[model samples]
Target: MEQLCDCDYEYDSEDQYTMPEFHQKYKDKLPLLVVVSGGFNGKTVYDEVSTNQVIWFHRVCQQSRVLGRLSNQAVRQYEEFVSIPVHSGHMFNVITSSRNESDPETLEDILTKHKLPVLVRLASEAYDYTLRTVKRYTILLLKTYTETFLQGNCLQDDILLPPPLLLAVSPDISVAIATGYVNKSKDTFHRKLRQISEFVKRNVELKEKEGCKEITLFDKQDSTTGTGNSIPPDLLPSYDEDFMYQDIEPDINWIPPIPPNPGFRPSLPARPPDGLLCQNDTPVDSEMESEKLSHKQSSDVSAGTFNSLTVYDDDESGYNSSAGSVKSYISDMSVEDIQSLLGALNLTKYKKDFRKHLIDGAMLEGLEETILREDFKFKHVEVIRLMKYIREGHMPKQ
Candidate 1:
């Protein structure tokens, strides 16, 4: 008898009289009965304890399943057990009945049981190599799942449903659940669900109106330009010569004028003898003849003795004239004008020093020699025009 009731019994002391011995000893004596008032209180206390235990059990089962400690079959059995409206006294029997010796249920079976069509579609559509066929199947499954489990009355009051289901139902609900808003208020959940349902309906109607039988999940063709399945023209950059090559125009306004070639000089026109001009109004033959004779004599002497000297003087004068012209041009220019001219000519290496030197009254001859030695090949007129623009404080258009 002790063994039979020992599972539910507790004792205050280990050395107390055994139950059987006590019963035999007291059998001959009159039995004592203690009356208890309010028997309903005991029942109420038991009910409260049992309800708490059941709630705890449900929570444990859910946690175990979510943590993957429980197999799908076990999850299903646990779900069934919790769904049964039984007192704590019968929980052991429910648990024993739900146990099975079969293999654990697979992931696919579990997903299917939960109405997870998106995952199912992903698994099924994976075998097909063709993008179009896979996309069509994917869209079809998504639309079907959205229409079915996501619509109405599928979720339980106490059970926290999966996120995908909530997402399919409404993004707002999913967000709310993530943020603990759904746990705080049931009205928010219901409101979000209604919004989701109405939104899904309107979406369906719009798709139907647009003649969209199935939306594409993966498009091989470019959609932006309605072009065939290749990269759009604007997106594809060109490596052709015309696109890569750019013509850089010389800045004529800021470039300095090219000086005249030193080796070439135009001959000067000859002037009549001074006496010849004065004698043109008189008709004295001897005097005029004597003047002509003297002029001839002077010309003969110059041609014979001083022709080389004359040529040397002419060359010197020509060089001096050119140097003077360039010097005058430089003197008239401001530092900014010189800097701009140098920059536009792409000769900016020594521009700062050169500008300083020019502003300090350095000879233009030295600058001209340096420019020539630097391999600048611009024409004289071009340099002049560029300097003019620089002086006017305007950059020439390329």
Candidate 2:
């Protein structure tokens, strides 16, 4: 009614029936045993279907079963008996004739009587099981094959694989296998990476063995105490050997190095002899001329010379006598002498231009009278001493 099936059907003429014709005539009958052969000989049979024809047959029977046209028992029988190939490697043959064959029957008569629909259905079911088994087994086999391939080739100098086998590999499955191989390789790489520090240390040790002495960057041991030597006696405690080894007691008399006292002044030297105008002439005299002059003034005043008050300007010797004028004394003084004079009078603000500023400041302070007495002699001697001290680069006593 549907213009027959369009599928190009092949059958042995002696069998007297095509698969489609058999299915159409006896669609509702008990399953009949069918012989299956070819390509499935001596080799181990994989569960998967080996051809497209098998796939097509499996789909047809599966549809028929779902539509309630095929019995569950019939499908089960087909799966158990027909799906699996026999162990024998020969042409599989089945006889559908009854034991008593007294009645004559043609090939078509035998096929129709036995019901070809049942044979077709059985064959289709077998193919379905084969296809499913092939798919599942293929995946498992592929995983094992890929793992072995990676193990052999991942780190090899020249990687090699059978081109046909590689071509047969599923792209997704292959990628998964390759990723696992890479991960395993990474673990190996990490282990190798950790050895880098050990390698460096080994090289350094080797260099030392070869007599390449390393330079010490810093020495922890004190240089002064090394070389079998002890610390200096000055640094040691001042105690007898027995006392030193025993539990020690603090010394009440032990004193720390004393710092100089800021308020203490050193006593100055005695005055230089008469005619010794320059301080350099009495280089070794520790006493300042100011102190000597003060002493002289005290003695003179005690002898009643304090009231005379007049200072004499001795022009020839450039010395200001006890009776000298202040102006003549100032005129006879050098720049260094003037600076010293200013310093002694506590008028250091005039030090830059001491001669003029000193005269101004002295007049402002009305120091002429003071200069005529003890103060004048002291200042005069101080100027001479300070000039000498500066020239010799000596720090004068305060």
- The candidate maximizing TM-score is 1
Residues 1-398 of candidate 2 have per-residue lDDT tens digits of 11121212222323423233433443344122111111111111111112101111101121000000111111112211111111111121122221112233332233345433221122111234343432221000000000001101111111222111100111111010011122246565344334433443343221111110111111113311111111223322122332112232323343222222222222433555653422334333334775775577678656544324433224533443322333333344434444554455454544442232222212322343244234333355554453332223223455
Cα displacement (angstroms), candidate 1, residue 5, comes to 99
How would you encode candidate 1's per-residue C-alpha lDDT over 127-227 as one tens digit per residue? 33332333232111111111101111112333323221100111111110111121346566455545545544453221111111111122223221111
How accurate locally, in lDDT, is each candidate? 0.28, 0.26
CA lDDT, candidate 1, residue 187: 69
Deviating ranges (above 4 Å) for candidate 1: 1-278, 283-325, 328-332, 348-398
TM-score of each: 0.18, 0.13
TM-score of 2: 0.13
